[model samples]
Target chain A: MFLPMVLNSLNPLLKETFVNELLKCNERTKDYGLVLTPEGAESIIEARNNILNSLGRVDMGIEVALGLIENFYTSTFINEENYVSVLNEFQEIFYYMKNETEDMISDDKLICIIKDYYENLCGGSLELLKSCLEEFIHDFRRKAHTAEAGLGGEE
Target chain B: MEQRDNSGQTLAVQSKINSTNLKKSQYTIALLNESFRVGLMSREEINNIQIQIMQILKELIARYTKGESSSVCAYTAESILNSILYCIDAYALGCDSPEEAICHLKSLQISKLYERGVKSVSRWLEEARELYKKVRKNKLNVGLESYDHTINEDIPLYFTNCGIVFDAHNGAASIDYQLTFDDMSINGILYMKNYLEHLWIENAFCKYFNSEDIEKLLSDFGRTIGMDYKIELINIFELVFNNAVFAILAGIPEGLRISQYHFDLLSGKLKALDDSEIDKYICQTVEKLVKNMNICELNILDYIYRYKTVFTQRVIRLVRIDSLRGIILTEKEEIKKGYTILFENGKEMKIEDFNLFIKKLMKLKNTEDKIALIKSGIESLNDFVDLLASDCLFGKEFEALFNELGDMELAILAKMALYEEIRSDFRGLRSVISEKKESRVEWHICFVEFLKKSGIDRIESIERLLGEIDYTEISFY
Candidate 1:
């Protein structure tokens, strides 16, 4: 249910695999999202422009600053209506996360919280999503580390 | 896929959907509805429905943002916004369970973009439409030849009913490279680089100006006028235009409608320097250029030739409107909201109907008020002559405190910003771009200010209706 509505009509078989892929993507997003300390988001955002020419992961360093989210707006892009709704949610979520960085939560718990959000708001689809999340986390971690090294060189 | 480990937080969301017979999942979205319904949902319930929709969107994003799908570079600002919406709509219409929803959203979204791309080329069509109207007014017929033929048969903005006509008809090109430096030489970047160079003086002035070829023209003009129009010897910069002149103009590929702002900036840059002050001026111009242009454009070793230009064909003509009113940052002719009013004829006419127009303009709540004001001003605008006729009133003493009607912002505020920056950074040169140019108006100001600044003679005869607004350095392009 937390899945963005833009991708709502899933074929029965592909649904089984897609859930896993999405979970993988989420993990990567999370890993990338938690690299920057809250204060570093601006610098990271500024760095995004520089990213045009190079493979350096300066933008990844920004998420490292944001850290993990317990209850944030869905990161899903969907139909116009849903897109707007989710954007509003993220606006609040990002603001709130920026305001409260000292507080931390476990990865599994965060995922569970996200699932709960989906269930209540739309409906529920948890297992397939979780299966794919680990891959996303791996990719995100790798990228974040690369960006961290880049930050070291700049200083 | 494994079960979600749920020893976390849990809450039971109350069914805000009060009516039992109505399917709660069938959320009524006001904007998305087929315009036929007159049904209304309470504000709170509407919000809940939207939140549910957002959750569906979140899931869709999860479904497709994998593989080489989201990696497409042709994506645009609108696309990013649209794709998110597309998936959500697919979700809303589907009866499939969560697993099946992902694939459907992904396939549908891509298909829509693919299908729409064929027709969504309305961007140029819209541009063509605007151009058609402008061309009709100006009575111009021009055509563009893009190398690629795909852009052909593309319904342009101008309409002949059978086919859309475009002012400039062309397509993108993929060309075979003719170079020694590999594929980098084949980049379609010359146009882009040229564009950036226009707005940012540092980027293009020297490149275009310092060329031996350009020097010949400048020297010739100088000899002809009995005064040097150095053109590019001095430093330069611009605001509102991209970092460089070329870069800024690049955004609007069509020829630009030149304004006082563009001229003012050019004058501030290429105006002649006195022989005695030449060295100081050179230092200042160089300093300003360094601070503003993209230093990366040229190799450091090519300093001598990087900016050198043999100025030729690209002839620029300028005329500046000087005033202390609402001319600052004026990208277009109409003055600021609080300062001046423009009529259909492109002239500022606020003095006669100032109070009533302003009071109504201030309370402008919707389209009707704005339209009414526009009509009233346009209908009998004999009181306000357009800037094209300013020549008629030249050499007159006018009592209008909000001087100059044409869109020029280089008056006081511009002087102030330039003064502050130059004094701190390029101070030794006496910070002159803001200084009055060689003009009869400056002669009058010099005569007046000389009397005021040092108890001498003033414009002793205060004649009726002679343009009293006197400022030195008014540009004549």
Candidate 2:
């Protein structure tokens, strides 16, 4: 009973859903060997659990994780040999983003910004994607603490 | 009532148990209980009352399970049960006949429980005991208002009774004793309120002493005990008294005993008690008490009289302008001229006109507004003091605001604020900056290099801005 509960309880479901979404991310994405292995899937599940436990239950945990994975999977940076290492990096980035953004940005919105930056601004570098996320979080937090009345999306 | 459904079968509408239904059911039980005791109620009446009460309680419990009244502590299944018991008792005691008792019980308001003697120390605590028993038996996860919710870990802490006896009986052998509850529980607060309220009710303290008399006694005690002559012993006593009452309410068992923390704060060793959980609890509880209590006979001010310092200290701790140690003033005292006032940013300004400076500084509330004033060229020591006390400037914002101000001292101050945020090692940087006291220009250069060594990325840009002395800009002093 506990086994099924843990397996089904948001974390594993999120990991499964994300990996399935990554498989269908794009046509060229499939040729790049960007698929997550069982071990890779397990690590995502562990990281998801850790994030959820620390941040309490967010309204969009699965969507956020899936969004990050799908965005990463579809990127031009996802080479055949770098898939495993990239997946590991994605886990850390996703975890960091969740906390740094303070769960204010919805999964869909955060994904939109990342996809925009990855395709247009940063020219498909994951390192630049991480930098953009850090800058966004810093500015987002600063405005949140100071400009309570002025910020539009927050309300 | 049956109604025909779309599928042509008769549907029976369920009788809902809402707030109105609950009140009506409570009234019915109360009436039945009264009649049953008076031997006017039939056996059927008793059975029906039992079934009705059970149904109402079941609905209340189900609502609790669904998280209703979860945020609020006033009403719960246990509390409602206790309310039913109290109503029954009040009806039984307040009236002679069953008919009269029914009328009396129906008129007894929840807020009037105090007047009805249903919320006295003995009655409320008896209900609490029963509630705790039920909680233990059922292993329910309900929050108890009487218990300290702040305690996360189960450490074995117990109550230590520190009883105080007042010997003010006109030189006669008269004594009044007060007991301490070393535990944090609502019962302790209620007990303290009960004791103090009883004193007011009986005018027990009046026969021997009054407020002024107590003040004189405290002063005598202070002198005999070698307490600081500057410290108002009467104010401390009143504060301690109110604090004791608050502690009881917050389920703090320690009562009103001065914790080592309070002593540390009083002695300038600790700058603020706001960080302390116990202090936070006391302030919150006292605020709640002040808002809720309605005493026509006894003014709360009379009890707390001229003791605003304790509350002020709880608001903002003013440390010494020179040594940066917290000055334990019950209220804000105007500083003398030539005293160097320090900000949290480690910048200090020597005041030329102390009284006027404080008067202006007290008018402002945030650092950003103060910085804005400085930006518009309001050159004064007052603006600097206000900036120090203001809350708006934090971490990166401090760096930005300092950049806009374009003062060398502020640049140094911004570096201090940034270093504080990153928890960077400042030992070597501090020694270098302290030694460069030859000229203001030399010290500024040394600090700029130190900022670069400390990994402040914007040092050169800040240094270039600092070179063009905007005398039109406000000085740090």
Off by over 4 Å in 2: A1-35, A47-63, A70-84, A101-104, A138-155, B1-179, B185-209, B226-477
- Per-residue CA lDDT of model 1 for B1-477, tens digit only, reads 211113322212122223332221222222223111222223443344344433433333323333111111112212333433433332333423322222232223433432343233344345445543432333211111220111123222113331211111121133221111122311112211222222223323334323342333333322222222332121221111212232222232212223446545544543343433433443443444444544454432143233322110111211122221111221222222332323222244565564455455546555444445544654222333222122222222211212322222212222232333322333221223335344344223332232233211111111110111122232221
Cα lDDT computed for each candidate against the true fold: 0.29, 0.41
**Candidate 1 chain B lDDT trough over 10 residues, lowest sum:** B310-319
In model 2, the Cα lDDT at residue B70 comes to: 14
lDDT of 1 at B422: 28
TM-scores of chain A across the candidates, in order, are 0.24, 0.59
The per-residue C-alpha lDDT of model 2 at residue A117 equals: 75
B1-477 in candidate 2: lDDT tens per residue?
343433444433222212232232234454555445554445664554443433443444335435221111112333444444444444344444334443333334423432353334345445434443333333212121111121111101101121111100011011122222111222231333333343232232122223443343333333222221222212223333543443344344433333335534443432433436435554566555444443333444444432334543443433323221221212212223232223222233444443454456456667666556545533444445355444434444444454454344554353333333212222233343444334333223433444544434354444332222222233433
Model 1 vs. true fold: TM: 0.20
Clashes of each: 88, 14
In angstroms, how far off is B363's CA in candidate 1?
A: 55
